[model samples]
Target: MQDQTFPWLTTLIVVPLVGAAVLWALPSALRRFARPVAVAFSLVVLALAAVATSTFDVSTAGTHQLREQTEWIPAIGASYALGVDGVGLALVLLSVVLVPLVLLAAWREHPDAPATGRAAVLGGDRIRHYMALVLVLEACMVAIFAARDVFLFYVVFEAMLIPVYFMVGAFGGLRRRYAAVKFLLFSLAGGLVMLAGVIALYLNGPGGPQGFLVENLIGTQMSTTTERLIFLAFFLAFAIKAPMWPVHTWLPDTAEQAPAGTSVLLVGVLDKVGTFGMLTLCLPLFPEASRWAAPVIIVLALISIIYGALLAIGQTDLMRLIAYTSVSHFGFIVLGIFAFTSVSIQGASFYMVNHGLSTGALFLLAGFLVARRGSQRIADFGGLQKVVPVLAGTFLVAGLSALSLPGLSTFVSEFLVLVGTFGANRPAAVVAALGVVLAALYVLLTYQRVFTGPVRDGLATTPDLSLREKVVVAPLLGLMLALGFYPAPALDLLREPAEQAMELVGVQDVEPAYTSTSTIDDGSDQ
Candidate 1:
C-alpha cells in the first residue's frame, strides 16, 4: 500500500455527504434554488475527483494508492481504512462523472409546488429531498469503492440501501413503493448472509486492533471447508448484487418504477460493486474456493447471458428491456472475472466503466422519451426519428453501443472477454457469444418499434432533445467514441490489476498450441 498524508479519499466521500446535509437544512426562502445548489455541489465533487485521478500513479496499478487509515473499533479489530487501485479508481471516476450528469438530467424532475395526497402526507420540498438523497448515495458509492478494511466496506455496502430506498419509494413512479420494498428485501438478504461470512472470516483471522484490514486477511490459514463456506457466503451476496439470472428479478421492477436518473445510478454504478468485490476481495481472500467454484459460476454466467438477452427481446416496457440488457452485460463481466486470464480480467475491469457510460446513456435517453410521451412502452411510440431527430439519433448511437458495435467502447471489452474465456473454457465462450446476436435483435427491434415507422397519433408533435438534455448526454457519447478509438490509456490502467488478480489465483494466460515461423529466400540464392 502507498499511503498519502492528505486524506483525498475521505474528502471525496465527505463533500457529497456535507452537500446532502446542507441541501436538507436550507432555509425555506432559499428552497427555490435547491436544484442549482445541488448541481453546483455535484460539479465541485466532480472537479475534486478529477484532481484525485490526476494524482493517481498508473505505474503502480496493482497495489492500492492514496491509502488512508485510522483505528476505529479496537475491540472488533476494524479500522477506518480507504484506498484505490486502478479498478477502484476507474469506478470512483465513473461514479463522480455520472452524478453531475444525473443531477442535470433530473433538474426539473421534482416539482417545486407543495405535494398533494400521499406526498403531502409526507410533507417536504420534493426536489430538495431527492437531490439530497442522490448526494448521500454518491458519498456511499465513493466510500464503498475506496474502502480497504473489510468492516468499512461492509458498513458502507449496507448503508447504501437507505438512500436508494427513499429515492425510489418516495420520489419514483406509481409502483415506487413496491419496487423499493422488493429491492430492499433482496439486498438485505444478501447483506445478512455476507455479514455472517464477515464474522466467520474475522474470527478465523489474527485478532488485533486492525485485524480486518484486507491486506492482513489475504493469506490467513484456514481449513478447506471453512474457506469454501465463507467464499460461498461472500459469493452469494455478490451474485445477488450482481443480480445474476435467478436472483435478478428485482432489477427490472426497480428500473421500471424508479425515476430515470435514479435508475442510471442504480444499474450503472451500484451493481458494479458485486463484480468488483468478486475481483478485488473474493479471489485474493479465498483463492482455493474461487478455483473450486469457477465451473459452477461460469455456468450461471452463461445462463445469464442467454437468459437476459432472450427476455430483453420479449420485453414491452422500454425500461425493462434496458434493465434486462444490463443483466446480459453483467454476465459478461462475471464470466471475464472467473475466466482467470489476465486479458479477461482486464476486459472485465474495462467493461465495468464502459457499461456505465453506454447503459447510463440508454437509461437517461429512455427516460427522456418516456417523459415526452408519458409512457415507457414501446407500443406507445413510433416515427420519432422525424419528429425528434436529435433525440432519435442519440438514442440510436447509445443503443448501438449497447449492442457492442465495432466502433464503440463496449466492443473492445466484450471482444477481450470472449477471446480470453475461449482459451480457458471453449464451450462457455461459445455459448456466451450467442448473446451478441441476441443483443442485435433486442436493440434494433426496439429502435424500430420506438423510433421508426409512421408517426404515432400522439407523438407527431413530440419535442426534440432540449439544450440541457443534450448537455447531459454529449459528454457520455463523446467518451464512448474517444475510448472506442483509442483504448490504450484505459487498458494501461487495467493491465496491472488484472495481472495481480491472475497472480493471486495462481493462473497464467493460456499459451498457444503451436508457433509458426517462415523464412524469406532471396532471388539470387534461388
Candidate 2:
C-alpha cells in the first residue's frame, strides 16, 4: 500500500540478505551475537512491512501497488521487478513477522549444544550459520511474494529451497538428511514442471519486456489445449508445494525430522506458495482452463481435507500430526480459490495469513516442549497442564485455533471457505465440512494424550514457559485473537483482490435459486 517511490519493498528484501552476509562474515569470536543480529534485522524488516501496509491504498486494491522495476535478463524478458497486491502483501508481511519470532524461538538451539548435528555443521560457530540461513530464507520468501515478473518469481521460488535444505539437512534430527533430500526432490520435480509452464508462457507471450510481467500476461490469448497443459504444469508444482494429497508425501517426513523453527517456516509460510500460485497465476493466466479444471480440483481439495484430517487423527508423532493438519488446511485454501466466488477467494486469501500465524505458533510451542522433554513422540509425556500450565495453555489455544474454534482467527477464514464452497459446489462442501469434525478430534485427542490426562513421571520437572519464550509467542497468540474478533481490516484489504480475481475469471456470485417469498407462494399454489 505504500508509495512505490519509497523503495520499501526492495529494502525489506535486501536488508535480511545483507544481515545474512554480515553474520556469515563475522569473526568466530563474535558469532555468538548472530541470533541477536538476525533478530534485529528481521525486526527492522517487519517494521518496514508495517510502514508499507500503513501507506497501502486499499481503494486501488485489485492491482499491484508499490511497483519497482529495472532491466534484468533482457534476452528472457525478465526484470528486477517487485510489487504487491493485497494477497501478496499479506504473505510478505507474514514472512517478516514470523522470521523474528522463529529466530527468537531458535535462539538457544545452537548455544546449548556441545556435540550435536547442529554443532557439527557449523562447528563452534553454530549460531552464525543457523541465523544466517534464517535471514536468507526470509529474503527469498519476500522476493517470491513481491516479484511482479513471472520469471523472477520462478527463480526465487526455486531459490527458496537452498537455505531450507541446509537448515533441515545440516541442523535437524537423526534422519534430517533423508527428510531434507525428500523435500528437495519433491520440490525440484515440481519446479521443473512449472518451469515448462513458465517457458511456454514466455514463448507464447506478447513481444518485448512486458511479456513476463504479471500485468501483461493476464488474459493473453492461448489455445485451449496449450493453456490446459501449462495450467497442469503450474498446478503440479503448486500442488506439490501445497502438498495436496498424493503429492503430499514429503511433508510429514520433513516435519518429523526438521527442527521446529524450520518446520514452522516450511509449513507456515512456504507452503502458502501453492495456494497463492493457484489464486495469482493459474486462474488469471488460464481462466478457461481453471474453470474447466474446477470440478477435478475441487474433488482433490475435498479429498485432501478429509484425508489429511484422518491422518492427523492417527498420528503418534506430534510434528507429523501438525504437518498433516496443514495438508488439511491447505485443502481449505485450494477449495476456496477454485470455488470461483468472491467470498471463497477472499476466505482463501485470509486463510493463508491466519494459518501461518496459528500454525507457526503451534510449531514453536511444540518445539519448546520437545526441547524440554527431549522427545517428539506425543505419548512421551502426559498431564502437562498440572506441571507447566502456561505452556500447556498456549498449546491448547493454538491447537483450538487450528481446529477452527468459534472465536479464533482460523475459524473466521475456515467458515468463509466452507460457506463459499457450498455456493460453488455443494457436494464438495458437504464432504469438506466433515474435516472440521475430524480436526476437533485430532486437536482434542492430541491434547488429551499430551496435556489433560494424569501426570506422568518426570513431567512434574518440566519447566513452565520462561519469560523469553512467552514473549516470543505472545504476539502470535495476540494476533490470532485480534484477527479472530475483528477480521474486517483483513477482509477489506482482500476484498478488491478477490473482486479482481473474480473479474479475471468472469465469475460472479450466483443468486439463490429460490427466494423466501417465492418459495412460500409456490408452496401455497401447490
Candidate 3:
C-alpha cells in the first residue's frame, strides 16, 4: 500500500498491451521478429510480476496490493478498480509466466498450415498477428484476475474471447472453423448471461451510499430465490466457460482444432475463468444460494470428473484426449470450490495454478511430439521411449504432475482438497477421490501407450526433444517439484483470504488433520 511499493497493477496491465502494439506495428516482412518480440514482451511482464511477488509481504497477501480504484461510470456506481489479493496475485503470476512459455512451446518450425484451402482466410502477417493476439489475451487475463470491480471484471472477462476466437479459427487444425464457432457461440452466450447478472447486481445493489464494487456487494441481503437465480446466471456463464461436462463438448473440439500454443493458453489459463469467477464472485455474492445449490453443483462436478476421464480413456487423438482430461480436472476444481471449506477453497486456488503449469506443459510437450511425429494420433506413435529419451522423460514428469503424483505440486493441493472436502462432505469427497485414481489411470495409460510402446518403424527417426524444448519444459517440471516440497509459504498467503471467505459463508471453527492448508468449494453449477 505504500506509495513507493510499486505500481504493480499498472505495470502488469500495460506492459503487455504496449508490447503487443509494437509487435503488431512491426513490418510483416520482418517475420522473424514476431516470436522474439512476443517473448520479450511477456518476459518483461513476468519480470515485473516476479518483482512484485518477491517484494510482496506474503503474510499480508490476503489484503489487496497496490490497488488503483477510480470512478468509471459514477452514475452507475461502477469504477475501474485494479487490485490483487493472494489468489488473484498467484494466478496473475501464473498467467504472466505462461505467455513466454506458450510462445516458446510452439517455437519449432511447423508446417505452413495447409494454405491450399483457406488461402484467402489465412493471408498476411499471420504469425505476428498470432503473437500479438497472445499478448492481448494475456493482458485481458491479468486484468480479469486483478479487477476488483465486478463490472470491470466482466469487461476483461468478455474481451478475452476476441484473441481466442481468432487463435482457434486462424491457427487450428481440421474442423477449426466449426470449433471456433462453437467456442465463440458458447462463450458469448455465457458472457451475455453473466452480463445480466452484472447489471442486476449493479442496479439492484445496496444503493444508499455507494455503488456496485465487489467489496461492497458482499453480505448484501437478497431473497434466497433472487440470489439463487442471480447465482445461476453467474454460474451458468462461468460453467460454460469452464466448459464443464455436457457444455464441455467444445473443449476437445477446440483443443484438437487449435494450435499447441493456443490450446495451452485456452485450457491452462482461459478455462480458469470459470473456477475463478466462482471463488471471486458467485459464492461471496450469494452464499445462501451457493449453499442451496451445493448438492447439484457437487453432483455435476463429480460427473465431469468421471465423464471427462472416461471420455479421455477412449480417446485416439492425443490432443482431444488432453482436452477431455482438462474437463475432468476442472471437475476437481469445481468440487473443491462448492465444498465450502477453507481447505477446499485454497486447494481449488492451488489447483488452478498447478493445472496451468502441468497442463500447459503437457499441451506444449504434446505439440512437440506432434510436430516431430507429424500426427497427433496414438496410432501414429509406437515406441517413442527409445528414440527420444529426453522427450519421453519430460513427458513422464508432466504426466506425473498431471496425475497428482505424491510430492508433485498437484498432489499436495489435491490431497488438501480431498481431505478438506471430507471434512465437509464425505460422500462427495469419496466420489472425488476416485477422480484422483482415474486421473492416474488416464495420464499413466496415455503416457504408456504414446511414449513407452515399441518404436513404430515410421517414427524410428523421431528425434529427442531439442534443447529449446527442454528449456521450455524444465521450469514447469521444476516448479512442480518445488511447490510440492514447500507449500507453506503459499498456504500462508491464502489463509486470511480463505478465512474471510469462510466468514462470509458462515463456515467456522473446523479443525483439520493438516494445520496449514485450507480448502473449500465455490458454488458454480446448479
Instruction: Give the per-residue lDDT digits (tens) of candidate 3, residues 237-311.
Output: 999998787789888888987888889999999999899998888878888888888899999999999899888
Which segments of candidate 3 are over 4 A away from where they belong? 1-6, 111-124, 208-210, 513-526
Report, for every candidate in turn, its global Cα lDDT versus the true structure.
Answer: 0.91, 0.89, 0.83
Model 3 worst lDDT window (10 residues): 114-123
| Model 3 lDDT, residue 399, Cα | 90
Q: What is the TM-score of each candidate against the true structure?
A: 0.95, 0.96, 0.93
Going through the candidates in the order shown, the clash numbers are 0, 2, 20
Winner by TM-score between candidate 3 and candidate 1: 1
lDDT of 2: 0.89
Relative to the unseen true structure, what is the C-alpha lDDT of residue 331 in candidate 3, on a scale of 0 to 100? 92
Q: Write the per-residue lDDT of candidate 1 for residues 72-176, one digit (tens) a residue.
A: 999999999999999999999999999999988987553432321112111247878888999999999999999999999999999999999998898776778
RMSD of each: 4.1, 2.4, 5.7
**How many clashing pairs does model 3 include?**
20
- Tens-place lDDT per residue, model 2, 1-526, is 3337778889988999999999999887887677788899999899889998887788877878888988888877988889899999999989999999988887766445432222222335776788899999999999998888999999999999999999989888788899999999999999999999999998888858667988789878989999999999999999999989989999999998888889999999999999989999998899999999999999999999999999999998899999999999999999999999888899999999999998999999988888777777888879998999999999999999999998889999999888887776778889999999999999999999999889887778888999989998999999999999999988898999998999998777754424312343456656
Worst 10 residues of 1 by lDDT: 114-123
TM-score between candidate 1 and the true structure: 0.95
